[model samples]
Target: MQETERLAEVRERIARAARVARRDLADVTLIAVSKTHAAETIVPLIEAGQRVFGENRVQEAEAKWPALAERYEDLQLHLVGQLQSNKAEAAVRLFDAIHSVDRPSLVDALARAIDREGRSPTLFVQVNIGDEPQKGGCAVAALPGLLDQARGAGLTIAGLMCVPPAGVEAAPYFALLAKLARDQGVPLLSMGMSDDFETAVTLGATHVRVGSALFGARA
Candidate 1:
C-alpha cells in the first residue's frame, strides 16, 4: 500500500481502537515514526496532514528537520529513541517531546541544556517495564526516585514511555506503564508501536509511535 493509504488505515485503526475503549479519538496522538526514512519519503505524509512525527536520533533529525520545518506548518517532532546525556541540548532544541529519559545524569544534563537553550521539550521517563537487562529504561523500582530527580531539576515530566519485550504479548506491559504513569501523577503515556498500538491505546496510551505500518518496512 502507498503511504497515504497506509496512513488512512492506521488512523482508522486508531479511531476504531479509541471507540472500542470509549476514549475520544482526539485524545490519542499518532506519531509517525519517520526515523530512517529520508525527507522525500516523509513529505507525502506531511502533505497528507500528518503533523506529528518522531525521530530516533538527534543528529539525523538535525540533518533533515530544519529544512522540513521551514516548509511545513505546525509540525511537531518527538525523540522516541534512547537519548545520550551529551546530546541533551541538541535533542531539546530539535524535538518537541522526548520519550527516553531514564537516568539522573540525563535529567541533570537535560536541565542544564534547557536552561542554556531556554527551550523545554516535554519529557517522559522510560521504564524498563520488562526489566530486561539490556534495555535502556530505568528499573521499575527506581521510578519514583528518578521522577523526583527529574522534577527537582526543573524538567517537566509529561508521562512515561516503554517498549515491551519483543515477540510477546504487549498488553500487560502497556497496562503496567499506565499504572506507573497514574501512580506518578503524570498524564501522558507514550507506549505502543506499529504492532501493538491498538492494545496500548486501549490501555491508556496517549501517544503511539508507528513506523512501518505507515512507511512500509525499512530496507
Candidate 2:
C-alpha cells in the first residue's frame, strides 16, 4: 500500500512538472529503476501503474525478469547501467531497451548479437557528460561517430543517455545533453534520476530513470 501511494505521488509530481514546463505528461516516460530490489517489491509499483522499469545489471535482471515479465502483460525493461561486450547477446535478448550503449566494442558486440538473435532492442548511446575517468559513456565528441556506427549496423538508435557528475547541480549537464541531442537531430534525451527528474522534464527529458524516490533507499 505504501509503495502504491509513493507511485501515485511520483506520477502526480511528474504530471505537475510537465504541466509547469508546458509539456504533455504523456511525453515523459518514467522508468522505475528496480536495481537491487527484488521482484516482489516491484509488483506493487507495477500494480500501481508503472509499466517501465530499469535495471543496472544483466545478470540480476535476467534472474528476476523472465518470471515477472511472464506474469505481467505490458512490462518494459531497460538496461540502464554499464553493459559489457560479453553480455550484449543476453542484454539484447532480455531487455526491451538498452541505455548504456557507450563504446565501439560494445557497439560491435550488440550489432552482432542483434544480427545473430534476430532482435534489436531500442539503443541509447550514453555520453560521459561529466568526462569523469571512471564512468562508462563515450566521450561527448565521440557521440556522432558512435551513433553512426550503431545506425550503420542496423541497430535502432533510440537517443542519448547520461549521468551528470555527483554533488553538483545537474541542470546544466541535462541541458547540455538535450542540446547535443537536438544538434544531432536525435529525438530522445534519457537524463535525470530520482532527485532532479522534474527539473530534467522541464528541460525536455523524454525519459527519466528514477530509483530511490520510487523504491526507497537501497541498503
Best model number under TM-score: 1
Each candidate structure's TM-score, on Cα atoms with residue i matched to residue i, is 0.99, 0.97
lDDT tens digits, residue span 57-155, model 1:
999999999999999999999999999999998998899999999999999999999999999898999999999999999999999999999888888
Worst 10 residues of 1 by lDDT: 147-156
Please report, in order, the local distance difference test score of every candidate based on alpha carbons.
0.95, 0.91
* Model 1 regions lying over 4 Å from their true place: none
Question: Superposing every Cα of model 1 onto the true structure, what RMSD results?
Answer: 0.6
- Output the lDDT of residue 170, model 1: 99
